[model samples]
Target: MTKKIEVLGSGCARCKQTTKVMEMAVKELGIDAVVEKVEDINEIVNRGVMATPAVAINGKIVFSGKIPSLEEAKALLSKS
Candidate 1:
């Protein structure tokens, strides 16, 4: 199954960094996944994320409030 991964933030540096990490992890793992950036405040709040730079895998929030390391992202992707 293809994983639906979302990076939520306001297009800031942290958010971009998270997106990059997620993309690299997906590429390295050779996983079928769609990574998207959620910049809309309403959407982010509706998703129940109180912090920016959050990560959601398959519609479930996995990480939030900080940028994750490459290995951390890889592990998250692997689980998905």
Candidate 2:
């Protein structure tokens, strides 16, 4: 199944970097998935994310507060 991956933030540098890392991880893993960025604060708050540069997979928030490394992203994807 194609994974639904979302990077949530305020469109800051860290958020952008997180998005890039996620996309790279996806490409490297060759996983069937989609990487998307969510900049809406309302949505982010509703998701209960108290930090920027958060990642949500399959509607569940997996990582937050900072940009994750490529290995971390890959590991997160692998588990999801």
Candidate 3:
């Protein structure tokens, strides 16, 4: 299945960085996935994310509150 990856934040630098990290991880891992940026506060809240720079994989949160390292993101995607 194609992995649905979301980086949720307020479009800040951290959020952008997190998105880039996820994209790079996806590229390096060579997996079928898509990285999306979720900046709407309502959507973030709806997802139950209380922090910025959160990562959701296949509609389930896997990381939050900070930018994940490349290795961490790769591992997360691998699991998805």
Best candidate (score: TM-score): 2
Against the hidden true structure, what lDDT does model 1 obtain?
0.95
- What are the TM-scores, per candidate, against the unseen true structure? 0.96, 0.98, 0.96
Number of the candidate with higher TM-score, 2 or 3: 2
> Which digits, one per residue and each the tens of the lDDT, describe model 1 over residues 1-80?
88999999999999999999999999999999999999999999999999889999999999999999999999998876
Order of the predicted models by TM-score, top scorer first: 2, 3, 1
Cα displacement (Å) at residue 42, model 2: 0.4
lDDT of 2: 0.97
**How accurate locally, in lDDT, is each candidate?**
0.95, 0.97, 0.93
lDDT string for model 3 (1-80, tens) is 78899999999999999999999999998898989999999999998999888999999999999899999999898887
- Candidate 3 regions exceeding 4 Å error are none
Pick the winner on lDDT between candidates 1 and 2: 2
Instruction: TM-score for candidate 1, please give it.
Output: 0.96
Look at candidate 3 and tell me the lDDT of residue 33: 90
TM-score of 3: 0.96
